[model samples]
Target: MALYRIADINVEYEPRFDMLRERSKKYLIGPSDKVNFKISIKNDDPSKPGDNNSGLSDAECEYIAVGSSFYKGLISFNGLLLHASAVAYENEAYLFSAPCGTGKSTHTSIWQKHFGKDKAVIINDDKPAIRLVNGIPYVYGTPFSGQFDISENISVKLKAITFLHRSDINTIKPMDGSKAIYSFLNQTIKPSEPELKLKAYKTLDTILNSVPVFEMGCNMDEEAAEVAYKAMKEGICNED
Candidate 1:
Protein backbone atom coordinates (compact mmCIF):
# COMPACT_ATOMS: atom_id res chain seq x y z
CA MET A 1 0.00 0.00 0.00
CA ALA A 2 1.09 3.54 -0.77
CA LEU A 3 -0.29 6.97 -0.06
CA TYR A 4 -0.61 9.31 -3.00
CA ARG A 5 -2.03 12.79 -3.21
CA ILE A 6 -4.74 13.56 -5.74
CA ALA A 7 -7.07 16.53 -5.96
CA ASP A 8 -6.02 17.80 -2.54
CA ILE A 9 -6.42 14.44 -0.82
CA ASN A 10 -3.87 11.88 0.25
CA VAL A 11 -5.33 8.55 -0.86
CA GLU A 12 -3.97 5.23 0.25
CA TYR A 13 -4.36 2.40 -2.21
CA GLU A 14 -3.71 -1.18 -1.18
CA PRO A 15 -2.48 -3.84 -3.66
CA ARG A 16 -1.31 -0.86 -5.70
CA PHE A 17 -2.47 0.63 -9.00
CA ASP A 18 0.38 0.92 -11.48
CA MET A 19 -1.14 3.63 -13.66
CA LEU A 20 -2.53 5.68 -10.79
CA ARG A 21 0.69 5.37 -8.81
CA GLU A 22 2.75 6.74 -11.67
CA ARG A 23 0.19 9.46 -12.41
CA SER A 24 0.14 10.74 -8.82
CA LYS A 25 3.87 11.22 -8.22
CA LYS A 26 3.67 14.93 -8.94
CA TYR A 27 0.81 15.33 -6.47
CA LEU A 28 2.33 13.44 -3.57
CA ILE A 29 1.95 15.39 -0.36
CA GLY A 30 3.29 15.10 3.17
CA PRO A 31 1.36 13.46 5.99
CA SER A 32 0.15 16.88 7.13
CA ASP A 33 -1.71 17.43 3.88
CA LYS A 34 -3.52 14.09 4.04
CA VAL A 35 -7.31 13.82 3.71
CA ASN A 36 -7.32 10.02 3.95
CA PHE A 37 -9.05 8.12 1.13
CA LYS A 38 -8.69 4.40 1.81
CA ILE A 39 -9.06 2.94 -1.68
CA SER A 40 -8.79 -0.71 -2.59
CA ILE A 41 -10.09 -3.10 -5.24
CA LYS A 42 -9.58 -6.85 -5.54
CA ASN A 43 -8.10 -8.26 -8.71
CA ASP A 44 -9.81 -11.08 -10.61
CA ASP A 45 -8.42 -14.58 -10.08
CA PRO A 46 -6.48 -15.26 -13.24
CA SER A 47 -6.65 -19.02 -12.87
CA LYS A 48 -10.42 -19.12 -12.41
CA PRO A 49 -11.24 -16.37 -14.92
CA GLY A 50 -13.06 -17.69 -17.98
CA ASP A 51 -12.97 -14.38 -19.73
CA ASN A 52 -11.81 -10.97 -18.51
CA ASN A 53 -15.19 -9.53 -19.57
CA SER A 54 -17.23 -12.29 -17.93
CA GLY A 55 -18.38 -9.50 -15.64
CA LEU A 56 -16.98 -6.13 -14.60
CA SER A 57 -13.27 -6.45 -15.28
CA ASP A 58 -10.58 -5.72 -12.73
CA ALA A 59 -9.70 -2.49 -14.52
CA GLU A 60 -13.29 -1.31 -14.59
CA CYS A 61 -13.75 -2.07 -10.91
CA GLU A 62 -10.51 -0.28 -10.10
CA TYR A 63 -11.73 2.75 -11.98
CA ILE A 64 -14.92 2.82 -9.94
CA ALA A 65 -13.01 2.44 -6.67
CA VAL A 66 -10.74 5.34 -7.49
CA GLY A 67 -13.62 7.60 -8.53
CA SER A 68 -15.71 6.77 -5.50
CA SER A 69 -12.81 7.47 -3.14
CA PHE A 70 -12.00 10.78 -4.79
CA TYR A 71 -15.60 12.01 -4.87
CA LYS A 72 -16.34 11.02 -1.31
CA GLY A 73 -13.26 12.86 -0.09
CA LEU A 74 -14.10 15.82 -2.33
CA ILE A 75 -17.74 16.08 -1.26
CA SER A 76 -16.78 16.41 2.35
CA PHE A 77 -14.90 19.59 1.48
CA ASN A 78 -17.35 21.07 -1.07
CA GLY A 79 -15.21 20.26 -4.08
CA LEU A 80 -16.51 19.10 -7.45
CA LEU A 81 -14.83 17.07 -10.17
CA LEU A 82 -15.76 18.38 -13.60
CA HIS A 83 -15.18 16.97 -17.07
CA ALA A 84 -13.78 20.01 -18.88
CA SER A 85 -10.66 21.42 -20.45
CA ALA A 86 -9.14 24.10 -18.21
CA VAL A 87 -6.54 26.69 -19.09
CA ALA A 88 -4.92 29.31 -16.91
CA TYR A 89 -4.42 32.79 -18.29
CA GLU A 90 -3.35 35.77 -16.22
CA ASN A 91 -3.86 33.84 -13.00
CA GLU A 92 -7.46 32.92 -13.78
CA ALA A 93 -8.80 29.57 -14.92
CA TYR A 94 -10.86 29.54 -18.11
CA LEU A 95 -12.61 26.24 -18.65
CA PHE A 96 -13.95 24.86 -21.93
CA SER A 97 -16.67 22.27 -21.51
CA ALA A 98 -18.47 20.19 -24.11
CA PRO A 99 -19.62 16.67 -24.83
CA CYS A 100 -16.89 14.21 -25.84
CA GLY A 101 -14.79 15.27 -28.85
CA THR A 102 -16.25 18.76 -29.31
CA GLY A 103 -12.70 20.17 -29.64
CA LYS A 104 -12.46 21.51 -26.13
CA SER A 105 -8.77 20.53 -25.96
CA THR A 106 -8.12 21.73 -29.49
CA HIS A 107 -9.59 25.11 -28.64
CA THR A 108 -7.39 25.43 -25.56
CA SER A 109 -4.33 24.46 -27.59
CA ILE A 110 -5.17 27.24 -30.03
CA TRP A 111 -5.35 29.67 -27.15
CA GLN A 112 -1.81 28.61 -26.21
CA LYS A 113 -0.67 29.26 -29.76
CA HIS A 114 -2.44 32.63 -29.80
CA PHE A 115 -0.98 33.75 -26.49
CA GLY A 116 2.44 32.11 -27.05
CA LYS A 117 4.63 30.48 -24.41
CA ASP A 118 3.78 31.18 -20.76
CA LYS A 119 0.96 33.53 -21.73
CA ALA A 120 -1.65 30.76 -21.62
CA VAL A 121 -1.17 27.53 -19.67
CA ILE A 122 -3.17 24.33 -19.61
CA ILE A 123 -4.14 23.73 -15.97
CA ASN A 124 -6.02 20.47 -16.35
CA ASP A 125 -6.65 18.99 -19.78
CA ASP A 126 -9.66 16.94 -18.69
CA LYS A 127 -10.82 16.56 -15.08
CA PRO A 128 -10.36 19.70 -12.98
CA ALA A 129 -11.41 19.94 -9.38
CA ILE A 130 -13.60 23.00 -8.85
CA ARG A 131 -14.10 24.08 -5.30
CA LEU A 132 -15.41 27.13 -3.52
CA VAL A 133 -13.07 28.13 -0.77
CA ASN A 134 -14.00 31.09 1.39
CA GLY A 135 -16.86 31.78 -1.04
CA ILE A 136 -14.47 32.22 -3.96
CA PRO A 137 -14.35 29.67 -6.76
CA TYR A 138 -11.04 28.02 -7.63
CA VAL A 139 -10.02 25.46 -10.24
CA TYR A 140 -7.56 22.77 -9.18
CA GLY A 141 -5.39 20.48 -11.28
CA THR A 142 -5.97 16.80 -10.67
CA PRO A 143 -4.13 13.60 -11.58
CA PHE A 144 -7.30 12.18 -13.21
CA SER A 145 -6.87 14.45 -16.25
CA GLY A 146 -8.32 12.27 -19.04
CA GLN A 147 -6.43 10.82 -21.98
CA PHE A 148 -4.11 13.81 -22.24
CA ASP A 149 -3.03 13.19 -18.64
CA ILE A 150 -1.82 16.74 -18.23
CA SER A 151 -2.12 18.39 -14.81
CA GLU A 152 -0.32 20.43 -12.19
CA ASN A 153 -0.81 20.57 -8.46
CA ILE A 154 -1.95 24.15 -8.64
CA SER A 155 -5.08 26.22 -8.11
CA VAL A 156 -6.30 29.31 -9.83
CA LYS A 157 -9.28 31.62 -9.55
CA LEU A 158 -12.01 30.43 -11.92
CA LYS A 159 -12.73 33.24 -14.34
CA ALA A 160 -15.35 31.57 -16.48
CA ILE A 161 -16.80 28.26 -17.59
CA THR A 162 -17.68 28.18 -21.29
CA PHE A 163 -19.83 25.61 -23.04
CA LEU A 164 -18.43 25.04 -26.50
CA HIS A 165 -20.10 23.92 -29.72
CA ARG A 166 -18.90 23.83 -33.30
CA SER A 167 -20.26 26.54 -35.53
CA ASP A 168 -19.25 27.87 -38.90
CA ILE A 169 -18.90 31.30 -37.35
CA ASN A 170 -17.00 32.45 -34.29
CA THR A 171 -18.88 34.12 -31.45
CA ILE A 172 -19.06 34.09 -27.67
CA LYS A 173 -22.05 34.99 -25.57
CA PRO A 174 -22.39 35.10 -21.80
CA MET A 175 -25.08 32.93 -20.25
CA ASP A 176 -26.87 33.31 -16.94
CA GLY A 177 -29.29 31.63 -14.54
CA SER A 178 -30.92 28.56 -16.05
CA LYS A 179 -28.70 28.44 -19.11
CA ALA A 180 -25.54 28.54 -17.04
CA ILE A 181 -26.84 25.92 -14.64
CA TYR A 182 -27.79 23.58 -17.43
CA SER A 183 -24.51 23.93 -19.27
CA PHE A 184 -22.37 23.31 -16.20
CA LEU A 185 -24.45 20.41 -14.96
CA ASN A 186 -24.00 18.64 -18.26
CA GLN A 187 -20.17 18.77 -17.91
CA THR A 188 -20.26 17.78 -14.24
CA ILE A 189 -20.83 14.48 -12.50
CA LYS A 190 -24.36 13.62 -11.44
CA PRO A 191 -24.22 11.16 -8.55
CA SER A 192 -27.03 8.61 -8.53
CA GLU A 193 -26.87 7.97 -4.78
CA PRO A 194 -29.14 10.38 -2.89
CA GLU A 195 -26.52 11.62 -0.43
CA LEU A 196 -23.95 12.27 -3.11
CA LYS A 197 -26.62 13.70 -5.44
CA LEU A 198 -27.63 16.31 -2.90
CA LYS A 199 -24.02 17.30 -2.30
CA ALA A 200 -23.39 17.63 -6.03
CA TYR A 201 -26.46 19.82 -6.43
CA LYS A 202 -25.33 22.18 -3.69
CA THR A 203 -21.81 22.44 -5.06
CA LEU A 204 -23.10 22.99 -8.60
CA ASP A 205 -25.49 25.70 -7.46
CA THR A 206 -22.62 27.57 -5.87
CA ILE A 207 -20.54 27.33 -9.07
CA LEU A 208 -23.37 28.69 -11.24
CA ASN A 209 -24.05 31.57 -8.87
CA SER A 210 -20.40 32.52 -8.39
CA VAL A 211 -18.86 32.56 -11.85
CA PRO A 212 -19.68 33.88 -15.29
CA VAL A 213 -20.71 31.19 -17.78
CA PHE A 214 -20.80 31.33 -21.55
CA GLU A 215 -21.77 29.39 -24.66
CA MET A 216 -19.27 29.74 -27.49
CA GLY A 217 -19.87 28.96 -31.12
CA CYS A 218 -16.53 28.42 -32.77
CA ASN A 219 -14.65 26.52 -35.44
CA MET A 220 -11.33 24.69 -35.14
CA ASP A 221 -9.19 27.57 -36.28
CA GLU A 222 -6.96 30.32 -34.94
CA GLU A 223 -9.42 33.04 -35.87
CA ALA A 224 -12.08 31.29 -33.87
CA ALA A 225 -9.77 31.03 -30.88
CA GLU A 226 -8.64 34.64 -31.12
CA VAL A 227 -12.20 35.89 -31.46
CA ALA A 228 -13.54 33.72 -28.68
CA TYR A 229 -10.78 34.60 -26.23
CA LYS A 230 -10.91 38.34 -26.89
CA ALA A 231 -14.68 38.53 -26.72
CA MET A 232 -14.98 36.40 -23.60
CA LYS A 233 -12.13 38.08 -21.75
CA GLU A 234 -13.14 41.63 -22.61
CA GLY A 235 -16.81 40.89 -22.03
CA ILE A 236 -16.15 39.52 -18.59
CA CYS A 237 -13.90 42.44 -17.67
CA ASN A 238 -16.45 44.94 -19.03
CA GLU A 239 -13.72 46.60 -21.03
CA ASP A 240 -14.18 48.39 -24.32
Candidate 2:
Protein backbone atom coordinates (compact mmCIF):
# COMPACT_ATOMS: atom_id res chain seq x y z
CA MET A 1 0.00 0.00 0.00
CA ALA A 2 1.16 3.49 -0.84
CA LEU A 3 -0.16 6.86 0.23
CA TYR A 4 -0.44 9.76 -2.15
CA ARG A 5 -1.63 13.27 -1.52
CA ILE A 6 -3.53 14.41 -4.59
CA ALA A 7 -5.77 17.47 -4.70
CA ASP A 8 -5.24 17.75 -0.93
CA ILE A 9 -6.76 14.34 -0.40
CA ASN A 10 -4.79 11.44 1.04
CA VAL A 11 -5.38 8.36 -1.07
CA GLU A 12 -4.13 4.87 -0.35
CA TYR A 13 -3.89 2.23 -3.04
CA GLU A 14 -1.76 -0.74 -3.98
CA PRO A 15 -0.32 -0.71 -7.46
CA ARG A 16 0.14 -4.08 -9.10
CA PHE A 17 2.57 -2.88 -11.74
CA ASP A 18 5.85 -1.05 -11.86
CA MET A 19 4.61 1.48 -14.37
CA LEU A 20 1.99 2.77 -11.97
CA ARG A 21 4.50 2.87 -9.14
CA GLU A 22 7.02 4.81 -11.23
CA ARG A 23 4.45 7.16 -12.64
CA SER A 24 3.15 8.07 -9.19
CA LYS A 25 6.58 8.25 -7.56
CA LYS A 26 6.52 11.99 -7.22
CA TYR A 27 3.20 12.01 -5.36
CA LEU A 28 4.28 9.39 -2.84
CA ILE A 29 4.06 10.25 0.82
CA GLY A 30 5.10 8.65 4.05
CA PRO A 31 3.02 5.89 5.59
CA SER A 32 -0.31 7.20 6.72
CA ASP A 33 -2.57 5.48 9.19
CA LYS A 34 -5.50 7.56 8.10
CA VAL A 35 -6.53 7.96 4.49
CA ASN A 36 -9.45 9.65 2.82
CA PHE A 37 -10.06 6.61 0.62
CA LYS A 38 -8.50 3.37 -0.56
CA ILE A 39 -8.54 1.96 -4.07
CA SER A 40 -8.28 -1.69 -5.07
CA ILE A 41 -8.06 -2.59 -8.73
CA LYS A 42 -9.37 -5.95 -9.83
CA ASN A 43 -8.71 -7.95 -12.97
CA ASP A 44 -12.25 -7.37 -14.13
CA ASP A 45 -12.29 -3.68 -13.24
CA PRO A 46 -14.62 -1.66 -15.43
CA SER A 47 -11.81 0.72 -16.30
CA LYS A 48 -10.03 -2.09 -18.13
CA PRO A 49 -12.98 -2.60 -20.52
CA GLY A 50 -12.01 -6.00 -22.02
CA ASP A 51 -8.87 -8.04 -22.54
CA ASN A 52 -6.89 -6.34 -25.35
CA ASN A 53 -10.02 -4.45 -26.38
CA SER A 54 -8.68 -1.16 -24.97
CA GLY A 55 -5.34 -1.79 -26.70
CA LEU A 56 -3.75 -1.12 -23.32
CA SER A 57 -1.21 -3.28 -21.58
CA ASP A 58 -1.84 -4.63 -18.09
CA ALA A 59 0.22 -1.85 -16.58
CA GLU A 60 -1.64 0.80 -18.56
CA CYS A 61 -4.95 -0.68 -17.53
CA GLU A 62 -3.94 -0.54 -13.86
CA TYR A 63 -2.88 3.05 -14.22
CA ILE A 64 -6.29 4.04 -15.58
CA ALA A 65 -8.11 1.88 -13.07
CA VAL A 66 -6.44 3.66 -10.19
CA GLY A 67 -7.20 7.03 -11.72
CA SER A 68 -10.85 6.17 -12.33
CA SER A 69 -11.32 5.02 -8.75
CA PHE A 70 -9.56 8.06 -7.38
CA TYR A 71 -11.63 10.42 -9.50
CA LYS A 72 -14.91 8.84 -8.46
CA GLY A 73 -13.91 9.19 -4.82
CA LEU A 74 -12.71 12.72 -5.45
CA ILE A 75 -16.29 13.92 -6.01
CA SER A 76 -16.87 13.30 -2.31
CA PHE A 77 -14.12 15.81 -1.54
CA ASN A 78 -15.58 18.51 -3.74
CA GLY A 79 -13.26 17.55 -6.59
CA LEU A 80 -13.62 16.24 -10.13
CA LEU A 81 -11.26 15.25 -12.89
CA LEU A 82 -11.31 17.43 -15.99
CA HIS A 83 -9.99 16.20 -19.29
CA ALA A 84 -7.91 19.25 -20.15
CA SER A 85 -4.49 20.74 -20.36
CA ALA A 86 -3.93 22.96 -17.32
CA VAL A 87 -1.36 25.68 -17.64
CA ALA A 88 -0.14 27.97 -14.87
CA TYR A 89 1.04 31.51 -15.43
CA GLU A 90 1.39 34.38 -12.99
CA ASN A 91 0.06 32.24 -10.14
CA GLU A 92 -3.19 31.45 -11.94
CA ALA A 93 -4.26 28.32 -13.80
CA TYR A 94 -5.92 28.41 -17.20
CA LEU A 95 -7.47 25.15 -18.35
CA PHE A 96 -7.94 24.47 -22.08
CA SER A 97 -10.43 21.67 -22.58
CA ALA A 98 -11.59 19.80 -25.67
CA PRO A 99 -12.30 16.33 -26.93
CA CYS A 100 -9.40 13.93 -27.59
CA GLY A 101 -7.20 14.76 -30.60
CA THR A 102 -8.56 18.33 -30.55
CA GLY A 103 -5.18 19.96 -29.87
CA LYS A 104 -5.66 20.90 -26.23
CA SER A 105 -2.02 20.04 -25.64
CA THR A 106 -1.02 21.81 -28.81
CA HIS A 107 -2.74 24.94 -27.61
CA THR A 108 -0.88 24.90 -24.32
CA SER A 109 2.38 24.33 -26.14
CA ILE A 110 1.69 27.56 -27.93
CA TRP A 111 1.34 29.27 -24.58
CA GLN A 112 4.69 27.87 -23.54
CA LYS A 113 6.30 29.18 -26.68
CA HIS A 114 4.63 32.57 -26.52
CA PHE A 115 5.35 33.19 -22.87
CA GLY A 116 8.54 31.15 -22.51
CA LYS A 117 9.29 28.58 -19.82
CA ASP A 118 10.02 31.22 -17.16
CA LYS A 119 6.49 32.54 -17.50
CA ALA A 120 4.26 29.62 -18.47
CA VAL A 121 4.24 26.02 -17.31
CA ILE A 122 1.97 23.10 -17.99
CA ILE A 123 0.74 22.01 -14.59
CA ASN A 124 -0.95 18.99 -16.03
CA ASP A 125 -1.09 18.13 -19.69
CA ASP A 126 -4.23 16.09 -19.20
CA LYS A 127 -6.64 14.87 -16.52
CA PRO A 128 -6.10 17.56 -13.94
CA ALA A 129 -8.25 17.53 -10.80
CA ILE A 130 -10.27 20.56 -9.77
CA ARG A 131 -11.45 21.08 -6.22
CA LEU A 132 -13.08 23.83 -4.21
CA VAL A 133 -11.01 24.94 -1.30
CA ASN A 134 -12.71 27.53 0.92
CA GLY A 135 -15.22 28.16 -1.86
CA ILE A 136 -12.47 28.93 -4.39
CA PRO A 137 -11.86 26.55 -7.25
CA TYR A 138 -8.28 25.34 -7.76
CA VAL A 139 -6.64 23.06 -10.29
CA TYR A 140 -4.17 20.37 -9.22
CA GLY A 141 -1.79 18.05 -11.02
CA THR A 142 -1.94 14.29 -10.81
CA PRO A 143 0.05 11.31 -12.03
CA PHE A 144 -2.76 10.28 -14.35
CA SER A 145 -1.66 12.93 -16.81
CA GLY A 146 -1.86 11.51 -20.32
CA GLN A 147 0.74 10.31 -22.80
CA PHE A 148 3.48 12.85 -22.34
CA ASP A 149 3.72 12.35 -18.56
CA ILE A 150 3.60 16.12 -18.30
CA SER A 151 2.43 16.94 -14.79
CA GLU A 152 3.50 18.72 -11.65
CA ASN A 153 2.66 18.09 -8.03
CA ILE A 154 1.25 21.53 -7.57
CA SER A 155 -2.00 23.45 -7.24
CA VAL A 156 -2.99 26.82 -8.58
CA LYS A 157 -6.12 28.89 -8.24
CA LEU A 158 -8.18 28.32 -11.34
CA LYS A 159 -8.62 31.58 -13.21
CA ALA A 160 -10.57 30.43 -16.23
CA ILE A 161 -11.60 27.45 -18.36
CA THR A 162 -11.70 27.70 -22.14
CA PHE A 163 -13.20 25.21 -24.55
CA LEU A 164 -11.37 25.14 -27.86
CA HIS A 165 -12.73 24.58 -31.35
CA ARG A 166 -10.64 24.32 -34.46
CA SER A 167 -11.12 27.18 -36.87
CA ASP A 168 -9.21 29.09 -39.49
CA ILE A 169 -9.68 32.39 -37.72
CA ASN A 170 -8.97 33.06 -34.05
CA THR A 171 -11.98 34.14 -32.02
CA ILE A 172 -12.98 33.93 -28.38
CA LYS A 173 -16.05 34.77 -26.34
CA PRO A 174 -17.31 34.19 -22.83
CA MET A 175 -19.80 31.40 -22.31
CA ASP A 176 -22.90 31.69 -20.18
CA GLY A 177 -23.05 29.77 -16.92
CA SER A 178 -25.69 27.33 -18.16
CA LYS A 179 -23.77 26.53 -21.29
CA ALA A 180 -20.51 26.34 -19.39
CA ILE A 181 -21.97 23.83 -16.98
CA TYR A 182 -23.16 21.63 -19.83
CA SER A 183 -19.80 21.83 -21.53
CA PHE A 184 -17.96 21.00 -18.34
CA LEU A 185 -20.18 18.00 -17.68
CA ASN A 186 -19.07 16.50 -20.94
CA GLN A 187 -15.40 16.94 -20.00
CA THR A 188 -15.70 15.31 -16.61
CA ILE A 189 -16.54 11.82 -15.49
CA LYS A 190 -20.15 11.82 -14.38
CA PRO A 191 -20.87 9.22 -11.76
CA SER A 192 -23.34 6.47 -12.48
CA GLU A 193 -24.80 6.47 -8.98
CA PRO A 194 -27.55 9.07 -8.56
CA GLU A 195 -26.24 10.51 -5.30
CA LEU A 196 -22.71 10.74 -6.54
CA LYS A 197 -23.93 12.33 -9.76
CA LEU A 198 -25.77 14.97 -7.76
CA LYS A 199 -22.62 15.72 -5.79
CA ALA A 200 -20.64 16.04 -8.98
CA TYR A 201 -23.15 18.50 -10.39
CA LYS A 202 -23.09 20.56 -7.23
CA THR A 203 -19.31 20.69 -7.31
CA LEU A 204 -19.34 21.69 -10.98
CA ASP A 205 -21.91 24.39 -10.28
CA THR A 206 -19.75 25.84 -7.57
CA ILE A 207 -16.72 25.90 -9.85
CA LEU A 208 -18.56 27.40 -12.81
CA ASN A 209 -20.01 30.10 -10.58
CA SER A 210 -16.61 31.17 -9.37
CA VAL A 211 -14.53 30.79 -12.53
CA PRO A 212 -15.13 32.37 -15.91
CA VAL A 213 -15.68 30.14 -18.94
CA PHE A 214 -14.93 30.85 -22.57
CA GLU A 215 -15.15 29.22 -25.98
CA MET A 216 -12.51 29.88 -28.57
CA GLY A 217 -12.30 29.15 -32.27
CA CYS A 218 -8.62 28.91 -32.94
CA ASN A 219 -5.91 27.40 -35.09
CA MET A 220 -2.42 26.25 -34.08
CA ASP A 221 -0.92 29.69 -33.77
CA GLU A 222 0.66 31.88 -31.12
CA GLU A 223 -2.08 34.45 -31.59
CA ALA A 224 -4.60 31.95 -30.33
CA ALA A 225 -2.86 31.75 -26.96
CA GLU A 226 -2.36 35.49 -26.86
CA VAL A 227 -6.05 36.14 -27.48
CA ALA A 228 -7.13 33.57 -24.94
CA TYR A 229 -4.75 34.91 -22.30
CA LYS A 230 -5.89 38.47 -22.78
CA ALA A 231 -9.51 37.54 -22.37
CA MET A 232 -9.14 35.09 -19.55
CA LYS A 233 -6.43 36.86 -17.58
CA GLU A 234 -6.89 40.55 -18.28
CA GLY A 235 -10.62 40.26 -19.12
CA ILE A 236 -9.96 42.43 -22.14
CA CYS A 237 -12.60 41.10 -24.46
CA ASN A 238 -13.55 43.02 -27.57
CA GLU A 239 -17.15 43.42 -26.48
CA ASP A 240 -16.52 43.71 -22.78
Best by lDDT: 2
**Candidate 1 C-alpha lDDT tens digits along 1-240:** 566666556777653555666676777655554546676555653432335456755544455456546756686578887778899988988989989989989999998888874888888998888888886879988767876578888899988888889988777877757987777777777767798778878888888787777788888778866776665677632222
Output candidate 2 Cα RMSD.
Answer: 1.5
Candidate-wise lDDT, in order: 0.75, 0.90
Which pairs clash in model 1? none
TM-score of 2: 0.95
Could you give candidate 2's per-residue lDDT for residues 60-95 as a string of tens digits?
888877888889999999998999999999999999
